[model samples]
Target: MNDKLRSKIIIIALAPIIFILNIITKSYPEFIEKYYSTGLDRPIRQGLSIITGVFPFSAAEFLIITLVIILVISFIVLFIKIVKGGFIKQLINILAFASSLYIIFMIFWGFNYNRISFDKIANLKIEKSSKEDLYKLCESLIARANTLRSKVYENPKGVMTIQGGYKDVFKREASGYEAASKIYPELGGKYGPPKRILLSEKMSYTGITGIYMPYTGEPNVNINVTDYMLPATAAHEMAHQRGFAREDEANYIAYVTCSMHPDNDFQYSGVMLAVIYSMNALADNDMESYKHLAKTYSEGVRRDLVYDSEYWQKYKGKTEKITNQVNNTYLKSNGQKDGVQSYGRMVDLLLAEYKKK
Candidate 1:
């Protein structure tokens, strides 16, 4: 066989190898956690983050744009060659390329999905919390958020604003994890700061706050989001960068890390995120209670919340809907059975932490 054919065969063979590795990971979470997530993955993640962090822009964004261009060009080429033979060969080549990506993903970051659950790692008891527990959590968070909002810098409109903006936010993101790591060593580690997407306004249309690029170990934030939530969004993406792959767990980590951060803006942003989740949970359990609790938000806090809601209202359309569905499917495929609802599930972790306090 020719060298090209041999290479094609080798790439095709990777399919079964990926299958076996997936099974192994699924069946042995402890082994994967010890060896893969904590062991082999560290240098790979750190190395990618260090290399990509040098560039001021989002390397992942550039790579994604480049890949899209390549795909469009490839499709045009295939269409031009439609009258010719070898369609089967081209199809096989496409499949091989896809398999190669999956293999690369497994090597880099996908295996973290199978790592031991964050609850187990953090030694927190996540039991089914009651309405009372949820209400208390909301009450505490709302009061805390109100106080922090008063202290944080605000825009003329009274909306909570990051003082130094994205530049300062990115610089401060690591400090939260630094403080949190003292108590939860699992969260401790040096990683690259998140990069702001150049096309952040476009990213807002998809209703995504932030994204973690596993291939590059970069936390990417949509800078278009309201300022009140930006710090927490950065924390959330950084949680994924830390190898906590589950959405709910990452959300919980974000809150905890932000709570630990020194700056009032970061602290307020984190507490506000927890308050929103807790209030939503309370609303589901008791609307009257939620209404009463909502009234407790301080003037400045209420102002920021109102403006944040309005900001998102402008992006409500088909793009956001489709993105939610796609996001749900993606989460489910990664073992998050509750999918989008898993985000709300962070309230459970919040309540657990509250009870401890």
Candidate 2:
């Protein structure tokens, strides 16, 4: 076969391959969770930290750098070819076509394969556990968190050194993870799990991002735990390590798991999140209770929440605002109502499940 004909055949074959992969990924949540996302992501993140050094450059940064280098090289080659005459234009055309194909494939794979759809996964379970069962599960987690909280708070200074700097909080969190592992060996593995956690040294708009499992094939999670967030953000990412992919499920699991754990820091982090969400729930009904709960939170948690909000607010630039508006429209196009904000609705399902129990 001619080279052109072979290229066409390859493109045709890729279409079906992409479709098959999409179907498999969408249909097998547990398989993916268990096989691809069941290890600690801290070490991968730590390596990324070292590789990127203190600069905190992201994948986006690397991509941008790569593109710039390619463009520069391409321009130089094309200019030389133009000066030489003949095949220069053809070469440039081939390069442009290849670059375009690469971009299209990236967009296709990103939207279809990279994105997580928890609602679809939840629906796939044949024997749906009752809400009461979920509640009981949550209760057990909460009980465990309470136990851990007492221990950490017993000698807070010993476990955590609060000297006011942001690095101090990172150190404290790292210590808490170490303590949790010592207290519960099953949760924190040796060597197999990530050793050092990576914080997006720069601020992020998202609450937290991390790989559910680093040893597994899953991607690393990168938490947007700026200096202002409550300790809960660390525990929340840890919940992802435990195999909760759904945002609300992660939030719920983080609260319950941390609450149940033997470490005081983990317990406090979990309860703090629960209190925040529960307060939001109560605000829809009892204003007085919401106010009381609001007051109950420590100044640190409140400040963190406020900081988290402000960070996102800054990113609402005109370009991002317009992009978000279009993105919401696109999300609604794909069976999600309330557009992108529907992620927060996971709380409704969690609350209902808790109440039924």
Candidate 3:
């Protein structure tokens, strides 16, 4: 074979090797947990994040835009090639590119899927939470949320608001993570602060609050979301940046990080997130008790929850459903077999922590 063809064949061969390695790692979580999470992933993610953090704008966002443009142009070119009867050569090129991208993705951040779970690392007792435990968790979260909401700024209508706006929240987010690191030093270290997406409004329509771009090691947040959610969402993405791969773990990290924040707004937001998840679980299992607990929310908490509901209400559409499905598929492909439902698993961590305390 010619050198170019030989190179293409080698690239294609390497993809399966990486796939096999991924399977092996999944089967040996203990080894991946010990060696990859503790020994390798942290340092690599930290280094990438530091390098990317130097830029004021998001390198990940830029990369995404560029990739989309490249894909579009490549498809146009491929169409023209097919018309000219060069289909086989173009197909080979596409396969090689796919293989290279897969390898790069795994090396950078995808391997975290194979690392130890946060529950294991945190030593959380992640048993199925009982209805009573769920209600108690909701009650605790509600009380804390009520107290924190009072200390935070409010809109003229008496709903909680971030005093300075989303940009300010982004700047302040690191302090939350820093406070959290006191408890889990693994999440410590300087990394890129969360970036505000320029297309945040578009992101809101898709029902995505935040995303961690593993390629650039940047956490990007949708600033257009309700102020009550911005802090927790930012912390959640930051957890992913810190190498916690599971959506539920990221959510729990965000809750802990924001709850520990000195700012009441963040604390309120964090507790409110916990309340939402816990209450939803309760609603699923014990409708009467959930309704009773829901009615007990302080006026301030109720108003904020209503405002949050209305904010999301405006964005529900086919686009949101499609985006959610895509995200669900992506999560499942990465071993989150429950897919989007895996996010609800954050309640398990919350319940375990509350029970411990």
Give TM per candidate: 0.95, 0.49, 0.95
- In angstroms, the error of model 1 at 1 is 2.7
Please report how far candidate 1 places residue 239 from its true position, in Å. 1.0
Writing each residue's lDDT as its tens digit, candidate 3 over 1-357 gives 799988998999999999999988898878876787766777788888889888988888889898888778777778999889887777778779789889888877778888877777777777766678888888888888778877888889988887789879988999988887887887888787888898889888899988898788899988888888889999999999987888888888989999889988888888988999888888888999999999889888999899889878989999999999999999888888532232257887888888988
Candidate 3 CA-lDDT value: 0.84
What lDDT score goes with residue 312 in model 1?
Answer: 88
Winner by TM-score between candidate 2 and candidate 1: 1
Give the C-alpha miss distance for residue 23 in model 2, angstroms.
3.2
Q: Candidate 2 regions off by >4 Å?
A: 1-12, 28-231, 235-244, 284-289, 292-357
Clash pairs, candidate 1, are none
Per-model C-alpha lDDT, please? 0.85, 0.45, 0.84
- Candidate 3 clashing pairs, residues 3+ apart or interchain: none
In model 1, what lDDT does residue 28 have? 89
- Evaluated at residue 75, the lDDT of candidate 3 is 75
lDDT of 1 by residue, 1-357 (tens): 889877877988987887688767887899988998889997788889999999999999998898778777766666666768676676666667767777887788888889987777777677776777778888989889878877888778878787788898999889999999999887878788899999999988999888898889999999998887888999999988888888888888999999999889999989988988888878877999999999998999899889988888988899999999999998887778532232255887777778877
lDDT of 2 by residue, 1-357 (tens): 777755655655565565466456656645544443432233443443344434333343444456678777767777777778755454645455454554443222222222334434333221233334333433443454344434443223222212343344333544444554554342353222222234443323332234333223122334444332234565555544433334465565555445555545656666656655644545655566456545644444555456556656754456655656775675454334431232144444444435444
- Name the weakest run of 10 consecutive residues (lDDT summed) in model 2: 153-162
What order do you get sorting by TM-score, best first? 1, 3, 2
